[model samples]
Target: MTVRTRLLDPAVARAMSAVSAAAKKGLGDPALAELVVIRASQLNHCAFCLDMHLGIARGHGVDERRLDLLAAWEEAEEVFDERERAALALTEAVTVLTDGFVPDDVYDRAAAHFDATRLAHLIGLIVAINNWNRVMVGRRIPPGGYTP
Candidate 1:
């Protein structure tokens, strides 16, 4: 089915395209990026991103248990480790940017987990997903159409 709204507007699409190289740099595992994408999309209720990321995550060997419990990763002791946790925290902070600018504590925690360059890329990932979420949610992209 055709999406009700375009998934990528010109500006957002350009921004995403610009970040492609940086996102591919040696910041973190591609698998971890997929994990963060899935978790953030799940939290933001963005069907387009959730669909894309879940498939990527699975291709990278993410198990069903972890995927199923992603929304509750904090409460569940899944396979996600400290670095993943830090990425998740950053995702949550950026995705919900209105809750306030990403707090220093959040940035510091993520910085601790990742090097300067990796942390920058990590933040970029968060920003990218959050932008995607806003577009999808704002346009009210319908769900149940995304197949894993």
Candidate 2:
């Protein structure tokens, strides 16, 4: 499918960029943030986002094996730490909202690993990526075009 729009209006793009900046500043770990983005993209099945985030994650030094195993993070705990697992769980919850609500257990687990501010940032990142995924998927934005 062809792209519906080459870019969002400048104002809207700026707002989205601000949200991304906030996420980058708020989330201390670049690798963790990329993981959250990658997982959300995978769940949303957005090829553009998946391509972009996978490249970003690799730039942040996320291991190839970990990225490969992220789709099955539950069964590949050996590759993920507690914090990564918690973030992935949160990503899944946020991405698949129709499957069920974000469970209290998942939120609590992520909270246990992150402070209130960081948790808010993590949530923001999840929400932001989902928003991007919807836009890209809806517009059928082609993949492999993003540089970062």
Candidate 3:
């Protein structure tokens, strides 16, 4: 597919950058953060993001096996820890909103694993990735073009 735009309008791009920077600062665990991003990108079917984030995730030392099983995280408890599972559950709940709004139980599970500050950061990361997914998908940004 042809690209629709090289970048979003300047104001929107700046806003997105700000959000991204804030999310990165808010979350401390690079590996966990990448998992959240990768999971959300997977759910959104954003190939550009998947390609980019997979590399970033690896750079953060996330395991190859975990990355391979991210799409099936629910069934791979042996590979994912409780914190990772909770984040994955939150990612699904937020990404698949049409399936239903995020359930309280899912939120509670994440809350149990993370304190309020980190929980907010996790939510921020989720929202930002979803936004990026929609923008890249809308632009038909090709996968494999991103370097990391």
User: What TM value does model 1 have?
Assistant: 0.81
Q: List lDDT for all candidates, in order.
A: 0.77, 0.89, 0.90
Q: Per-residue lDDT tens digits of candidate 1, residues 3-31?
A: 66655668767877577437745565887
TM-score for each candidate, following the candidate numbering = 0.81, 0.94, 0.94
RMSD of candidate 1 to the truth, in angstroms, is 3.1
| Clashes, model 2 | 0
> What tens-digit string does per-residue lDDT give for candidate 3 at 23-127?
867888899988999999998899999999999999999989999999999999899999989999998899998656999999999999999998998999899
**Which lDDT tens digits does candidate 2 get at residues 1-148?**
7888777678877898789779867988999998889888888889988898899889989999999998999999799999999999998998897656999999999999999999999999998888888888887888987864
Model 3 stretches with alpha carbons more than 4 Å out = none
lDDT of 3: 0.90
For candidate 3, give the lDDT of residue 33. 88
Per the 3 Å backbone cut-off, how many clashing residue pairs does candidate 1 have? 0
When superposed on Cα atoms, how far off is each prediction in RMSD? 3.1, 1.3, 1.3
Worst 10 residues of 1 by lDDT: 19-28
